[model samples]
Target: MADTEPEKTAPQEHVHTSTDYPEGAQVEIPQGWMYRSRKLGPITFPWYASPQSQLVLVAFVCFLCPGMFNALGGLGGGGQVTAYVGDASNTALYSTFALVGFFAGTITNALGIRIALSFGGIGYCIYTSSYLCFDHTQNFGYSVFAGFFLGICAGVLWCAQGAIMMSYPPEHQKGRYIAVFWGIFNMGGVIGALIPLGQNIHTTSNSTVTDGTYIGFIVLTFLGACLAWTLCDAKKVIRSDGTRVILMQHPTWKSEFIGLWETLISDPWIICLWPMFFASNWFYTYQFNDVNLAQFNTRTRSLNNVLYWFFQIVGAVLSSFILDFPGMRRTTRAKVVWCSLVVLTFAIWGGGYAFQTTYTRAEVNKGANTPLDPSDDYVKMDWTSHGYIGPMFLFIFYGVYDAAWQTSIYWFMGATTNNSRKLANFAGFYKGIQSAGAAIIWRLDGLDAPPPYMNIFASCWALLAGGLIIAAPVLLMKIKDTVSVEEDVKFTDESVDDVVAHKIGHEAVDQEKV
Candidate 1:
């Protein structure tokens, strides 16, 4: 609920309800559709999870297969996910994610978030279960089966997530809500890491993961799918103030594309951020799944993931506090995100050192069955890898780094834009590009050593470059243009019918211009 009374305001519905909007005009949405405004400067960090965050959390937990076990599934049969059938599926996943995401607003608008969530959830179920069966049957068919659906699901669910994240919370709490939403759902990574540790603890090495382990993934996958069924669509969402947000855009295909084109042309940030956003997930996938998981021993890898999730939560929570820290200006808050993400990029490369610490060596070989030499600098195992202490500590630290980088992206995207429909489009665009990045690496999985050979530092730096690219364009643009002055004013001095009408998106206004 708005903390203050509804001041006399312009009919916000007029933004959307205007029959005169040109083709592809962005309709104004209910206030409930926008994120809550903060009294303080730019960031919206809450100390605790809001009840409203359950949607993101539930969606995330159900997303276990995509980021969690399936990512690890590559470790099966010596990085089967990257090296063999999974390579094809991984490409399909992102390609589909990008393709579907370009126009996912239509899907959500037509079918609603529930169906998209369910479809995405079911995709996870199929992908997770199919991967297990493929591994069991050595069938290429199931691998392809899983990737296609997962890609489509990623496109749909992500758009839904963006809509809900921006809309469900109040302005002040939006940042915090995003933090909690992401922090909780990321627990899937922790759970995924733990499951393999338990299932494969007795195994000789990172050989074929046990059938029972696949069964575990299957069960967890379905549990997540069930949760998806329970999720509500964004339009129907009940906001904090107990008002139901009416349905926004149910754009026709042509209108959606036109709107998307208009947005891309008008918003410089969207164009600049696209490359980085597209490649975002790929770096992590290659580093953690293809490289780290491929190289480490079972116990060490397991311990690494334990650290990954545990510290990730800490990082996410702590980073949120940084966002909400009292007295910080909006620029300072953004800088915090930028600097942290940049530093974390180095930390990703630091994984090489961590990988070196393990006694396991490159458990998987490069093509031609090249010997995985523990003594060679390339395959050399480090004391950190050898010792549980080093691996655990790194995971914890990486968690914070991961938390800072990942959560910042979500919050940053929402904070900058108040357009619920555009926000959904942004989310879809981000994920679609992310899929493209992942797909590139899936192709290299079959190789003995994926691109840039052994220079993990370079790889991490590349990811940092992407993060920097994402931040650079936004910061370079004048602060006022990106963060509407009127929107900021609404935080404290809410006037009757004046500030908010201008503060929120004006696609309908754009339509007038058109």
Candidate 2:
């Protein structure tokens, strides 16, 4: 029996290196798909097959659809959620974002990427469509349900997206891949940001959005769902070139949780990142969403989003290249990450400064003191709200901050471990904590508008500061003396393809004998 038995297959091993490889050198890419390049002129670079490239391209396109919808959805709050739902319903719409974010990750782990992203996208499509009914209804129930649904969708989508973005790229070129991924991700933000600009959202002081804007958002939201399917299925293990490595079957739920918890408890550095993970999304303006809309004016709101995304896309793309320059060392990227705290600090404190300096006492007082209603336009825009310049700076610098932290953290995780699936679990943990923090912020924001004089933005400086306190010490210890590192790229089409084929052959022989 022992002699007759088939030989067992070996586990796949991932290889990484720190030796600097020259940029654009011919490296072994594991992909099996190709794309035509039109960069030269009317003609093209012949189709180069690489499945990995296709995944990245599809992911980018998918991101834009949801990003645009998300941008437009921001307008729904503060009495604009719908005419009949009223200002109070803003709580339901805004808070759900935090509520479902992390939980979605667990579900993703259970359902795999395709279900997580597809349903999440579908959820957005429904949520966006529901906005069409906002003007026609007064029950508020539908609005609440839609908001909850969207929140759940957002949570899962972000979790799956983060996992894929971080894990799928080859070890050697993760920085550039991340940059392109995030750049495309935010490009959607830019498009969505511009949508509101056309609505001339600034023309009136009332909390209102144009119908055309709603139509655009709905169509775009559905389109994102369509593209969601174009990405690689999570049920398969895919290599850098988008070639299938192996079919991934579901593990028992018990083992999954056990593994997830083991990964979390075993890593102190990751645990350190947890607090800030929660704090990261906590600083946003939703707590003041309705009031700010009234006090600052729609132009300020729309333009801020537009401006935020523009610099963010640029920053995200550039940071990717800078972090991975030919001669750049790990120490350099580490330094940028450490420096991010300064921007983080300034960005945090700057929000309050902008709020205080931009508007008059009367405008601040009115937005804060008055009862919010769809028709109320008591608060006015201070053209001098150059104070928004603060967030603009933040949007720009935070772009750097986001680029640094997100890219660095993912890179750090990969550098620390060879297990891509394990890395995803870690991502889930981080995202879960992040969502919890965001949800808490939303929950609080929905409950009460921060005091008019307190600069709701000002009060949270402590939470972020506290988060940094935990994050900085751990990160510095881990990266304080980083060295330059790079992946020595190696791959060949037939050789790489043969590995998978060989494994399939073994499995086939075993099956045939059985």
lDDT of 1 at 465: 68
Q: Please provide TM-scores, in order, for all candidate models, with all chains considered together.
A: 0.74, 0.74
Candidate 2: list runs displaced more than 4 Å: 1-58, 73-106, 234-250, 286-294, 351-379, 382-415, 453-455, 476-514
TM-score computed on alpha carbons, candidate 1: 0.74
Among all windows of 10 consecutive residues in model 2, the one with the lowest summed lDDT is 484-493
Q: In order, what lDDT does every prediction score?
A: 0.56, 0.53
Q: Write the per-residue lDDT of candidate 1 for residues 1-514, one digit (tens) a residue.
A: 6598667844544343222222343334333322433222232222212237445655475446454643354243223323455556676776787788877755665566666666766677677666567766767776776788788886887777766776556445666777777666667766776777787666444444556666766677666656666554443343343223323434566655665666576665666676567546655555465444555655556656666666767887887786666567655677776776666666655675555444332434433233222222334123254454654565466567656766777776766755555666777777777777667766565454454434443554576566576567575453222343233322222221222222222311211210
